[model samples]
Target: MSNIIETKVCSEIGDIEGVILHTPGSEVENMTPGNAERALYSDILNLSVAEQEYKQLKQVLNKITKTFEVKDLLTEILEINEVKESLVNNICKSENVKPIKSSLLSLESGELARQLIEGVPLNKTTLTGFLSDERNALRPLHNFFFTRDASMSVYDHVLIGKMANKVRERESMVMEAIFNHSSKIKSKTLNPSSSKHHKDEITIEGGDVLVAREDILVIGTGLRTTTQGIDFIIKKIKKNKGKHSIVVQQLPSKPESFIHLDMVFTLLDRDKCMVYDPIIMQPNKYQTILISIDNGKVKKIEKQSNLVDCLRDLGMPLEPVYCGGKKDIWIQEREQWHSGANFFAVGPGKVIGYARNVYTLEEMNSNGFEIIDAQSVVDGKIQLSDYEKYVIAINGSELARGGGGARCMTMPIRRKKVDW
Candidate 1:
């Protein structure tokens, strides 16, 4: 396939045709204990180890379909003088470092792309800069490896994330610029911040939103995404002339592990979904609401029993697959923390996840998904076409520590429409 691709994702478990990835680079290793918390990480990661693990994912996806790296795409767009100026201006103005705009634009596209992801060293020429404790004038995007959080493709449009944390706002801006300026990709973008309904409380991350079907969306509201953020999506749906259903699942805000919906739930196949038992299956204070829209207006709004049941009622029944098996909640909690439930579907019934989550992999295996090592596929020792249902397991001892799984590390740009 050519590099020119149109962005379209009508379902969560569709066969992926094209995806965007960011291999963990100097940006990830640039963090220290002092700034780990600000970077949304519980602990600092070893770049070498993380890169080794990430290679499995990249190679497997490359074997299956077209894969575009974030750095490559950014570099391609930066080659255009107008786009280079506009993007540099946006980043500098947004970060309140307008003084460096001219310097940034002076660099070549490749070097400029490197500095945007990696940190640009603080120019200590100013007395205040010399006195500051900060290491980088524009902090490195430490969480950029988790490409799913910044922006997402919904149907034919890309919804630019209104990141909950200010530290990650640049990721969204970069993504918006890619979609708007990249000649290789064709799609429109919907930015919540650019809309009239934008507010401080309205924040939406890609990890919190799932496209269940062409007209159905399953979204989670918690710390990273707010009720107001879902409302912003609702407003956008209202403008379209068709019936749409949205399942709003409320997530707990206490544990940082529950920061996004993908941490506890993900679509694995046309008839199946992976879920954490405690929060998604068992009874709890968290509420699930169903909102129905028709002809540009909300037709009905009601509380749902749960996510699975809500989708079942909407004609998309999905059998729930336990993240850590159905036997013990203790094991479930341990595995869920490592993103056991986060599975990225390359095709219907074909998915990828962390190999460290043994119990979760066991549960998936028992449910008919053959456990295949990602390295085996990368080495040409195995072919995915030989299995009807399979999960490619990638080494994740280090990547999981970064608080995401295969699904979180990927952003699908184009998917083959599923034959429902």
Candidate 2:
């Protein structure tokens, strides 16, 4: 096989080639009651629980794909002269830690890497530094564990996210550098803020965008991605000569659980999907609009019944599998809040998700899926590839509290094309 990795993700369900993941660090543990919400966490995760849960995910993924750690990728890319200098300068300036740039540059590669994600401690010598309660001169990227938000892969190109929150902006910048400058792969990078067609109002996050097929895309709009963001995607799709379509679904903003499209809906197979019943099945004022692009032009834009209905009309039909086992609405709501619908597909009929959502797992098991544990799969007690289709549920108690699941944590860069 060639050493150069190519970006070839064409479907949500495909044999995996490479995936991006970030190992949780002290940065995750650095959260306190004072800045928990600001750090994108309602409660700080117990590090031990998060790490154990994460190990299961890592081991399972390692068995299947060429897994890459974010810190290692960032460190490798930062070793380049121009890239290293520019990234540090930009990061320091943006976070207003210019005074520490020289000190930061002096650190060895290993130490520097840890500091970037875990954060740099305040000097505490100067009056301002002494009184500053902020542990980091540059704040920790507490949400870096959720690698999907910083960058996304679309066909052979990478879309560098423009975060709605400034705290996560550097995560985007770091991801952009890894995709653009790292020796890992070759792919074009698109920055929404600096794109020639970028709009002043456009705000997109990778968490909201789901790649269904080579020509079809499903996006959720709520807190992270907006109408302008969807329009921004439309402009990109309109430039392509081949067949392409964009399905935009508006998401609710109140309850934080409705953060991304995947939070409420995600693909389980070519013909099946996991969904939060209330938001997706039980219709509300939220709209599901489909935009058709015909030969680089806006051909049609119309409302559809729901996301499942829209995808079915477009010929990618998927039967809806409700989160929380399809029983009480209360059970559905409770589990949905914990990312019950969020699962990542490794291939058609083969997927992975959190095992804590027992109700959700029960639904999948009843639907002809052989449920397996992550450790079982990793230890060879269970074989994922042996079964044509299976749901591999991994434990994520503390990690789930971070408000994500398998789909939210993984950034799949490439997958074998489906027979479809």
Candidate 3:
């Protein structure tokens, strides 16, 4: 067994110690055009191409810090007979596939892990099964590669995401099981379902939550995350005795690109942030609210002029870098649609993003960010430590179509404390 990795993430740009990643697999290709919408995808992905693109991301991270694959972690915990039976039973009951419980339990740990993720083929022996159009008894988790959505590390605890869509709920279940039962991980899980304040309407995803500082959080609420979900987090903070602030940004319900805050806004450095102008800077009807908590009680809640200004008042002032160049709105919209603003910070002033956003890359360059190709770093042609501030650009021609960027693909498990 590997050494236990405790969950500790207090800031977005802290030096990463360990992170969780899921490489694109058969599950991503399992979707067809017929069920693409149901799987939360606008289009189907080419597994081969996606795999090639994902390799750049995986390799780059592997070189920088310890990385754990979801399948490997899940498989390790499944080797424990009790954990396996319990997880299988919970999944079967949740998905209403109890009939397959015994069958699932019979498989070896490795095979069982694969089947759990790749999906279980349906048996046509029954009349209903033969007549059904469904291809699998339990549907494949197409969005599993976006590992940031299911669960997130908050300080010393893991917050199990309550997925907005029913189809993605199993992803959360699998993640919760891994965190709760894995002997190789040390952390308590905070599940909304188990909370006394839990409600059916509460839904939160990892992509919507960003740890700005040890005492501050930035959360987005829209299609994927609800207001009630933010309230749940507020309640959790109320239990802790300290000053805490949550910056809530209301998001657009349409144009799927705005599904999460990270898609339109992400921290680039201690004093810099990437943003899509239309939604974040040139704001419209969307509102930014600041909620402050002190000594286990609600101190104040009020509307803010903008996110940047709000954070500035709270002491963390940041300069905004437009997603595309400042010249054209058309270019900004185009690149932002493909996740131009989504950059994952490995450390302060050090990040990763898509190289396809030429305009966005140009903007970053103008703002003193040295752009480097991901392959160069992976192949040892270039050393990342040589640059104090650089954005490692990965080829995202195919991966971006899945509706996320570098931040959407990573879930930080442990990070070194920032000397602020």
Candidate 4:
């Protein structure tokens, strides 16, 4: 029950103590063919299959560290009388269904928790409501189960996202309230909408922000996070007055797979990085921009060949492991779309990723990370702690369809500082 808080995420390769996660709920079924793509999903998922895949991740995590479910945390926070009333009211008002807040408040905790994620059905008692095809008053949180995107824990402070869509805004609001009010955790939070220092133009998502090192951050700017969002991060760095470096990578505009930084770039180990060959490693039109801040001053802003090159200049040269294992470019493109490059570091040398990405895993094996089945780790047949470097490869066929990988499905709250 440590309440330690952090505002800066210094490194990605550290021991994770606790992480926040949301297991898929009934809200996933509420979505239909009508708004699936708009919700950022290609098609409606079979909740059963998705849940099974999520369980593998959940089970594996349970073996290594303390895991807190988002619903449980939300339910606990709602028990506080002041927080309960204020949160429900604020949520209702924000979602444009203020009339229902009173009704929501009277419900018991179990029901309320279900409704929050599964959604409150669009009351169709009136003629206007009956004619309207809208499915929910407070629409189902189709993306809540993918907890990694809404908000992120960077160092001691939580970075509350400015969701690209209004439908997901409540997720950020809820996460912020949790970090601020929860007695279980101690953390300061940075938010675009609530921060006085940040202009209203700023918009950032946890998916686009990656803590590459204690002094380095790799960010993606395209659809989800805008230039304004990057500037907002710079504002935080400016105020901190430390030697901080930010590398901004421009991603593709279409084919949503390239939406977040983790999609194309992620830390595998101290000296290795998983990368999409075309966008990150090979030469293309994309630009890698570097911004350096020293002692509250805009020290340097320059263009580099790529992220690896920029990092090399800064003394952190990472060996780029191609997603498709240096084979044909077509395979690289196909695998990258399914999140081959997204690997989550459970600790300094312990990582997790999809075993389906054979080439990607092969590359990792070539780089000296022993491959181990996630089930072995969970069932205690194999000990992850026994190895200095290993990857808990999990079955991710169904999970990858949700447009994420191990890194995209997690939100780490506490990680030990890396030696680097």
In order of lDDT, best first, we have 1, 3, 2, 4
User: Can you tell me which runs of candidate 2 are displaced by over 4 Å?
Assistant: 196-200
* lDDT tens readout by residue for model 1, 19-115: 9999999999998898999999998899999999999899999999999899999999999999899999989998998988888989999999999
Superposed by TM-score, candidate 4 places the C-alpha of residue 173 at a distance from the truth, in angstroms, of 1.0
* Residue ranges of candidate 1 with Cα displaced over 4 Å: none
TM-score of 3: 0.98
* Residue range 1-420, candidate 3, lDDT tens digits: 568888899999999999999998998989889999999999888889999999889999998999999999999989999899989998999999999999999999999999899899999999999999999998888999999999999887899999999899989988998998877778889988875665788999999999999999999999999999999999988888889999999999989999999988999889999989888887689999999999999889999999999999999999999999899999999999999999999999999999999999999999999999999999999998899999999999899999999999999999999887
Model 4 residue 246 distance off true place after TM-score fit, in angstroms: 0.9
Model 2 / residue 392 / CA error / Å? 0.8
lDDT per residue (tens digit) for residues 1-420 in model 4: 435433335678788887888888787877778888767789777889889888989999998877888888788788888888888887888888998898899987767877887789878998988999887888888888778777887656688898888888888877887888877777888877866754566778878888888778889999889888888888877877579999999999878899898999988778888888888877888899999999878798998999998998989989888897897888888888888988888887689999888888888899888999988887899977689889899988778888888888888888878876
Where in model 4 is the C-alpha error above 4 Å?
Answer: 1-8, 195-200
lDDT: the better of candidates 1 and 4: 1
Weakest ten-residue segment in model 2 by summed lDDT: 193-202
lDDT of 3: 0.92
Q: What is candidate 1's CA lDDT for residue 65?
A: 92
Candidate with better lDDT, 1 vs 3: 1
Better TM-score candidate (3, 4): 3
